[model samples]
Target: MPVVPVGRSADNAVTTSPQRQRPTIAIVGAGIAGLAAAWELVAGPDSQGGDGPEVVVLESSDRIGGKLRSTEFAGRNVDLAADAFLAQRPEATGLCDELDLTGELVPVGASGASIWARGRLRPMPEGLSLGVPTRSWWPFYRSGILSTGESLRVATDLVVPHRGTVGVTGDRSVGDIVGERLGRPIVERLVDPLIGGIHAGGVDDLSAAATFPQLIAASRQSGSLLRQLGRARVPAPRSAAPPPLFWSLRGTTASLAVALAGALARRGVAVHTGVSVDAVERAGPAGANGATHPSWTIALGGSGPPPTGAVVMADGTSSLRVDGVVLAAPAREAAVLLGPLAPVAAGLLSAVEYASVALVTLAFDPGAIRSPLHGTGFLVPRISTFDGRPALITGCTYLGRKWPHLARPGDELLRVSVGRFGDSRPAGLDDDELTAAVFAELTRLLDIVGTPVETMVTRWNGAFPQYRVGHLDRVARIEQSVAELGGVAVAGATYRGVGIPACIGSGQTAARLVLESLSAGADPAGRSPGRVDPTR
Candidate 1:
């Protein structure tokens, strides 16, 4: 593929248009999803055709990785955001295999996290599926996380079973289904801490269809929810141990993004950081041969390096005219960029909400802890209180214990997470105040003796997008509106799943969508024939 020369212009209009051999696609945002999209454009089976599309990725941040980041802590590299990805989801592991990093994939060293209930840390019950007891009731009853009355309420599911509708209904909140079946106590104690913690929001408003479809599917059965979930479980061989629940790279899960960015760069894809996309608008009318014309114009800002093939306007701004575009940015940013082209998509994207969270990593002398660190970590339900107030810390991870590679003889590393949807207490406190408060809670929960040897706080504002009831419908509308713009698509956690694997899948899917649109010579104002499947 020949490089499209950069041309300077005194006006906002594109000044150069030379015949090109391959289609050029610009990907906005350099996060995992965006990087994944660029990879697909340059190396996927479709890209194997002749010369692949000229791909360029732009990010507003100074670095390539978005929320997937790691830093040196206690003489080892530790992840500040997500530490691992679900092994059941193949995207992350498949990406690792493709990058030849499969050998570096490491399963979590520990298991069986506990929950703080009734003023004590109790081991989470076994045979639980996303916090709902799927197997026998004996294990859950013996865990002692619930009171006698609460246990009896849970037993009602088996004795006097609550029969839900015979078929799958419209979207319902996770909290409503679980509370109705098992009891409110179960939702408050078990379900909220596990499922709710994943999205950093309460389950009461979270959409079951979007978040936990397994639960929703099981709920539709006539009999017990527990029995239905148990039947749905795919059994493993009795002779072998179960597979690992989660996996991370040897260095850190963050390395997945780093490795992906490197791989994209190696494929001749221009990956630029600290560059923000200002707007995405239609260029002039299609050429006599519609397939050859660049249909979209992307306005660029920020002090980041100019795109290698961008047209430099006299106003000092950079712009790229591309055959297609993938708006792989965050929901808010995508909304702003799509406002001029797709007002419906912009409005729906703007309405999506996000949750902020802080992870405080602290290292303490091994001897300072009174009790032995067990399992990976423990979760604090929103209802759990500390010192007569609602708990400030949502959960805590024994980083060194969970990832043995990070363990040191001198100190034990702990990561404490705070804040969630509708929780503003953490936002009010500065780093020092937040760290101190988290430590105080840790001191009581873990029976720590003194202060930490080192402390670091990482804040991820607007990190987790809430999947409220009817979220999937909203995403469908957003996708449909954008599809009408022809050769453009949006991808990210805000539209689909938020896990690393989900984000990767979302990006690849978006790539395929735009590629189809461009190859078919889609009309900019006409409906796209191949709209993305929202259920994916």
Candidate 2:
């Protein structure tokens, strides 16, 4: 097969035609990563008189958005999944704008949040990002979140020498770093639960450097993490937005997948589902005759279009020989697929651990609980979330108050969080038992009580990745290994962050990498795709 030339022309008009001849890109996953990659390739400029770059996205799942799963429950819609992205998380916000969805964004209202700690419900001390108290003094002396002595210790976070010792694995676990720097009180009570809970990683294994880059930057940049946080600013208020609260599509995060999928379809991407790729072996370049096109023997064993270029794993399964392959699966999953392509990367991918988590959504007659369900719920400190025990409730979002569609007069919507992986799941406990447990805990701490009108429980094993200290080295190693694989790259929460924004950014980054590789006349592996573009 003769090497198909790139620089194909872009009509750039509203019209899209499958004129063929342009470089073909195969995207394996339809998830955000894959979709983003495919969109990037399709949107690239090609001078050829023919069509622009072509993209094919293959997904194994019937639907898309791995782990960002959301399903309908009760007469109301429960996030049964992720509800919002931090306003500060740039990646997700940027993607929304790029997708023209930024206007739809809603910030969690300013009603404020609380933390379930030290046997009670206390307002999240102002100046706290996650559990790291930005304002050490107020919380230290006045807040109920920590004891006076504990607060002083936390406030002394100013003086804790940076003791982030790298482990033999050559990385620092969040456990050692935070413990050394902030001490046990902060780590056990707030840091562990708030920050640690995000990735479901315990302090001992979470990577402070990789997982919480900003936090580390805070400490390094300002000499004190507390000081850096003390300056943290909330996003400006907006009125045109719906409810001005952290928001999600009335459906589920799945709506994001649907929107992207639809957008891809409109953009002329060939989307194939139920396709399973066994293995990806590099095929030789197309001969000068052009009869033998650079292709992938679709391992479907069943049937499908014989594969080709810009292989994007939108759904996370790694496969294809194209301009590039962007992996968008969990780190462990990436580890399994890229093992042969990049061993160290595979090792690092495997090494970057994940924690299991469970989310329980309990519905109640608003009047049932002691206090009116307000603002966002509370976070159970790691001590409470850990202890191999789930807090009576990690936090409850007043769903109705959050999004207008979620709740209304006479009806109420409340989502109760339960277990974090490594913490005991709410299994074995019946609905009544779980509800009672939550109530007991809530009552014990918040001084509220009432019976649930209805309840829902969910458990996610390895919900998010815990980038322990030295995670950067691990990721760098993995990147080098992937580079050697020729046309493959990895992206997603497993590498950078766990928020919807970060993941979306990962997808966009992977897309840009693919674009850059293309313009450089490099194949998926950075070599010429088919013919040596001597010009380069």
- Candidate that scores best on TM-score: 1
For candidate 2, give the lDDT of residue 83: 77
Clash count list over all predictions:
0, 49
Q: Which candidate is the best by lDDT?
A: 1
Give per-residue CA lDDT, model 1, range 401-451, as digits (tens): 899888889998899999999998888999999999998888778888888
Which ranges in model 1 have alpha carbons more than 4 Å from their true place?
1-18, 285-289, 292-294, 527-536
Model 1: residue 170 alpha-carbon error in angstroms = 1.0
Q: What lDDT tens digits, residue by residue, belong to model 2 across residues 1-536? A: 22321122222110112233455455666666667666666654452234665566766666676666676666755565677766555655555565677666655544666666676667766556666766446644576677877777776767865443233234456566567666787777777767766776666777766766555555455356566656653545665653442446545545666677777777777666666455544444333124123233222321343233323333433334343456666777677766555567777788765665556565665566666444566666655643455454555666766666666565566666666545564665766677677666655554445656667767666677767667777777777666554445677777777777767777777766654554444334433233332221
